[model samples]
Target chain A: MTSQFPSTDDVILGPGDDAAVVAAPDGRTVATTDLLVEGRHFRREWSTARDVGHRAVAQNYADVVAMGARPTGLLIGFAAPADLPLAWAEEFTAGVREECALAGGAVVGGDMVGSDTLTIAVTALGDLEGRAPVRRDGARAGDVVAYTGHLGLSAAGLALLERGVDGPADCLSEHRRPSPPYAAGPEAAVLGATAMLDISDGLVQDLGHICRASGVRVDLESDALRPEPALLEAVRVLGAPAGNAVAAARRLMAVGGEDHALAAVFPPETGLPEHWHAVGVVAEAPRGSEEVPEHPVTLDGDVVERGGWDHFRRE
Target chain B: MTSQFPSTDDVILGPGDDAAVVAAPDGRTVATTDLLVEGRHFRREWSTARDVGHRAVAQNYADVVAMGARPTGLLIGFAAPADLPLAWAEEFTAGVREECALAGGAVVGGDMVGSDTLTIAVTALGDLEGRAPVRRDGARAGDVVAYTGHLGLSAAGLALLERGVDGPADCLSEHRRPSPPYAAGPEAAVLGATAMLDISDGLVQDLGHICRASGVRVDLESDALRPEPALLEAVRVLGAPAGNAVAAARRLMAVGGEDHALAAVFPPETGLPEHWHAVGVVAEAPRGSEEVPEHPVTLDGDVVERGGWDHFRRE
Candidate 1:
């Protein structure tokens, strides 16, 4: 563990000691944790050790970034059987280093233990840079909902993989190692985003969480929430039926998870960040709608009924 | 997850947000992560879910405290099968809350995922309160080695459990939930201690780490390092021959892990803090030895060869 860490400026103390001390110059630290289990989160046959490592760091770092914080350090824990190869550990460590460098951070400490199966857990820390955190409960009526990064590529990719269809490498990689819009989070915060979160569990499902927290309803404009070209191509290759492509695309965009996109609500007058696209508008719930259905997210006047992944439930 | 977090002053932002923002008033944060896997680090039949949770938090918090920092927040990740009882999750969470409160911290955020078996990972954050962190490499030749809290009770407890012996409940509880001497870390720092660490991997084994890092040898006085009465009683009940109790006690003290006792090197002239006992002294390595004696820990002029737990290897 001592030799695994490379000295970085923000790390005052590194892995050899009992704990690591990281610089939190803004007097606060943004922290989050994630777990990726073999066969459940990723199959060993489908993902390389490097892909697993990169994906773990990317998803955890996305949470910190969505809070408008710049990541500074990571602490990881791995549990694997004793028979696991040392080369796998080395490759995984390299992947962690690569992703942290890409996100402008470092792995200062970690722990390893023995288990029956492979498991990786990462906790990422970030510096807020003197700004108040952009929380999920600050969305309000008339706030414009915007997002940055790929929307449905990950879901489409998974769909293709599930069907055993030979697909584009980029699409499969999207499912393996997502490329979150890392810089856009703090940028949105700087551009006066009122509320923000990472879209890890499908856009609609995660947005519903924000709606419940903020007590506001969100109506998405289907025309504005278009799927990416990769997702469109995947839908074409899926070939559900003639004229079914549009519905398939819409379904993928609405309920696909693991995109790691940044979703934020900004005042109507505030300009959206460069990479962000406006997709919806926040509104008050209808006062007396006993007959009308009540839902947090709607697309072009229709409720999105599909649910995202729930760890404890089957589809 | 939102309802699970009670508002705490140190947690500026809690579970509902993308990530938790915790106050780190001294411009630095201490961090550590640990993983507890079912049937490896813990066994479902032997430990209650609550006991697993408490032990996980206790061990990780000890690492941060060993750095002379006061724990402020925790971020946890748990992976278990979908069929696992909800009551177990609730009990584990309650255990986390209880331990955090005991350590003067709170659970700021957490994530849950599905897996074949139970795995719990925790990342603890701490505040230094303007003091420089005490590291492992600061020990010097003439420094008095001191320790606080139980040294062999955990091992003795494990022995009783393994043999199915009906022993004292306190010893069994010590194995299930270790109560680390959390306060002694910052106290040692404030009292001008040179170096510090938690003895989680047995006395001689962990002391060897301090020796290798500080480039000094440690000589432990057998009388000063004797086991407590409880451990002696446990040894008596084990019925190793009448003359072997002392050896049994010494073996337990030298190789017991999970005690979570704070070990430090303080200047001889400085007064020892309350609850701390002087047990050894740091000394220069012997000269003209080609092999460097192949060991850094000497117990009553003999090198201790009994090994502690190694995660990736069998004993």
Candidate 2:
């Protein structure tokens, strides 16, 4: 069943057992782990316990889905000081359940421990339905690159929060709790995606991972990278100068991370899914090109330097 | 292949990929998580990082094996201060690998993050090989209970450590790195175990879990629970009074924790496994008795108080 609506719960075993059992009829499991530290990954001043919980589950589930699998079960390792309020933990658990519901995943088990710092370590599992995983190394020359999901909203939201300014609610909210494009993952896999990845470390940087792994170069079509109306509205409302909205959007798409968007490569002739927009094309090494091109990712015909979040980040 | 020595590697994917894939030929997965904190679970002054790593994996792997599953994969979420020495991490990793080899598990994936306090959260997965899990609730009134592996050594070693005294090599080493009865789990399952558990919180306390879950009372034969020579040696070396050494070992068997031994309930007609020693018998409540008995666990017809490890431990 699709996560767009409710589906049957997939728990084979819940908490209170020595361990949890999850059904894996495909004879394989797609698993990923994500660790979030309080001050480094989220700040209590900026996000609620519920928001932190949702963010943690969303990112790890996105990774499983990106591998062309259906997210099924989640196990959490949560730690906080003895003084942490019970209400905070309850809210955090509620958020974890909420996201698991949306992702069609079961909260099967977890480990709770006491520590000086608040920490969350999550392990997510997914079923692949007997399909070959859409690995990052599967992209080929002449493949077309497309991405589905919001691009600039999260970056703009972070900017608004740092400046203490008001922008579109969607903008600020995206930064607080990421809503990854869950359905796009399996949909791309079904459509014969050649390669896939979840964009957590920004678009260009993550796509570079696809490029280096597949030994190909990807060139973005600048015309297709236009800013959506909401992003432009946020840029203008945040007091950006006239004519800078487009550049702001470009930077957000290029370097701002944590949107948890889904990006995939498909054979050029394969019909693109309705929600996927073709924004780039993969290229082979030129006649004399080396094993790995120095610049494997580009905007139009120019190269983009990889930089830290400071390039477009507010914090 | 058995983990008594080397066998085939089980890795399907390492940490380099966005997510890891693992074989689940049994069409089901047994998963468990354990979170260990710095001071609450281990102290760096007392444990090398390698010891901490082994302790962490041993406990989690034991849980899976307790459910009649074969350990297959491990995922670690490690967090520590920015200034922690790199050598600590390497040694910790080596310890993880060593234990995984002994338990027949692969380090499939992990998340490394930075936090103020050192925290290691682990998720271990196991394959059941199409066998039904030996749940704690499956025991019948006439079942027999048996256990294999060292029981009181860990508690006795902890006692010696607290007093800055030395004990037998195996005694102190058991406290440092738990050597769980890995093979006894599946071996018990094949021998038709009805209920099973890992003894992490001392023998009587853990067996009480099975008694409560299965709605039957267990009576341990005091003859089988006599202190072993090494435990007595530990008590004597820790400077216990002559006659008190036996009392000390008996206390360790009753209340010491973290020995990670396998305890299982078997049908009355089943022959006990090679290394297993029959130590107890399951008893149904008398006619018209309440659902659960007031005292579900007894030693030699006498009710034994379930006390904290502090009763026999120094820390």
Highest DockQ: which candidate? 2
The sequence of per-residue lDDT tens digits that candidate 2 reaches over residues A36-145 is 99889988878888898789899999999999999988888889889999888887877787898888888778888889999999999999888888898888888999
- CAPRI tier for the interface of model 2: high
lDDT of 2 by residue, B16-94 (tens): 6678888888888898998998989888877898898799899999999999999988888889899989888888887
- Please report, as a residue range, the 10-residue window in candidate 1 chain B with the lowest summed lDDT: B306-315
Model 2 segments beyond 4 Å from truth? A1-9, A237-239, A286-290, A306-315, B1-10, B286-290, B308-315
Q: Give interface RMSD (Å), model 1.
A: 0.7
In candidate 2, the second chain superimposes onto the true chain B with a TM-score of 0.92
